[model samples]
Target: MRALAAAALAGVLVAALPATAALAADPKPDIAVTSAADKANYAEGETFTITVTVKNKSSVDAKRVHYTGGDSEGVDDVVYGELSTGFDLAAGATKTVQLTGKTNHVAWQRGYGYVAFELAADNGEANDADNITSVRLMVAGAFDDLGGYVFQGESYDAGWTPQTPGVEGVKVVATSADGKTKYAEATTDARGLFRLAQLPAGEVLLTFTAPAGWKILAGENGEYDHTPALVIADDSDEPQIYVPAKKVPVSSPSASPSASPSASSVAPSASPSAGPGLPVTGDNTMLFAVAGAVAVAAGIALALVARRRRVHLQA
Candidate 1:
């Protein structure tokens, strides 16, 4: 009877062990937003597509997984996608959804925009923070505003040290390559700062109207019609304009003929007088002048729109 009773107890304990292990296992599934991305840059009013990926990390399947896209900055708004549809995501599987969006006119104001994506599962996720992702986009078009400073100096160094002072009252105009379409124009302020707004994005010539006897030095990189070819793109970096300094005349008393040395005896003045204009050294000589002036006048302030995200709790 003792042997039979001990065998019965062992059988009951073995049956209860399976039930206890099942109760200790995790019940909730783990869903994560793996990625969200779009084109790095877009033209204003252009239609762009965004792709968001969702994954189920847990061994248990996730039911009715849904995603949503939103523009926190209001610059780019998602127009159409499977925003409301929900579908099952198998365990350790990923789903990628494609969405379409349009860039607003004001997108170029901030130079960039952002879109956010979030995921939710019916079974809930172990980590809610992993359900959110965002993408950044740079906007470029006619809605952009282009501004810079014009200085009377040689090319600046990589560290952006201006070799000369600002040239005041210089007229800077943005025109087509053929000079047929005049998009925008502005006169440099006392500090040689000029701003051209609402200029179309593309290759445009920057022609300068300077004071008499002053020369407009062509930029170092691209030259269009003897002027700088300013490509209005994402505006990641502002362009520079350097005006040749005006030459000042130096007067001297006439020397007697006896004091004058023969042409061969006269060594070129160790220091020659200033010329009417500076020679074009290279394409990159004046690249830093405008950027340097802008840094000194007012600090460059670029505010990138931040990505916004939220978690949706599902039953």
Candidate 2:
């Protein structure tokens, strides 16, 4: 009776193992970022700091988690901060991250910039909507932008023809008229649009740097008083010199026949000639053996002669 009772208890425990594992396999961690600015107002180009509070609201621990946030316009655009570098957060726990940023030179007439951020985790989440947050700051004054679009162009004897496709990743820079001081710089995006804000009031030179394998047809370098009005049109903008794409040369097949002869074309002669004009018949094994020996001797002699020539050349 004792052995039978022990077996029944063991069977019950075994049956419960699957349920326990199924419960353990289900992971739910909700990550969220509660963002706030350190101050309400910042002067144009004044550096400021913000805090982002990261929270895991679920009962389960969140693992391999990270957070992403930056200035409203772009990362480090008006504000910058250190993002979470993948960490584990205990159940219902929260961690705060800090970021530093400079207020943009160009802002609304009333002066306002936004800081945005989001949170994520490797473990599945219960809800994703609450993971993002943003904060606004008042920045005084407005600034001009050095911005424009770059396009593809084709060159002809008369002039250049502009195309609709925009060139991306062109480095645009704003500098003083003498090319000494650099005010702001930015790279063109997919739409070939670039903007450099925080530009001081003065004459500036705009230089465009093309990516690898691409040439700056026009607007390589130019002077501007105000934000120069540049369009894809030639008359409206500077002369855009476009070089056509190079043509690939085609190869033609050679006229010579194949160097190697086919096996079917190679065949044994009908009569076996043992010597010059000497055809042998059956039972010529001895004759063939003698001929093979002579041929081997001639080969050894030729090899020795070649070796001797090599030695002489070395000497």
Number of the top-ranking candidate, with TM-score as the measure: 1
Which 10-residue window of candidate 2 scores lowest in summed lDDT? 225-234
> Tens-digit lDDT track for model 2 on 1-315?
999999999999999999999988887999877878787767766677788788889998988677655337422444233365677888899888777776654433324666676767777777879988887776544445545666554431113233456668878777766778877888777766676666643345667776765555443232221222211111222222222211124456578876786665554355665444434344566788899999999999999999999999999
CA lDDT for candidate 2: 0.62
Candidate 1 lDDT over residue span 10-58, tens digit each:
9999999999898777576788875444676787677777776778888
TM-score for each of the candidates: 0.39, 0.36
Looking at model 1, the pairs that clash are: 155-285, 220-283, 220-284
Q: After superposition, how far is residue 124 of candidate 1 from its true place, in Å?
A: 0.6
List lDDT for all candidates, in order.
Answer: 0.65, 0.62
Q: Tell me how far the alpha carbon of residue 254 in candidate 1 is from the true structure, in angstroms, after superposition.
A: 46
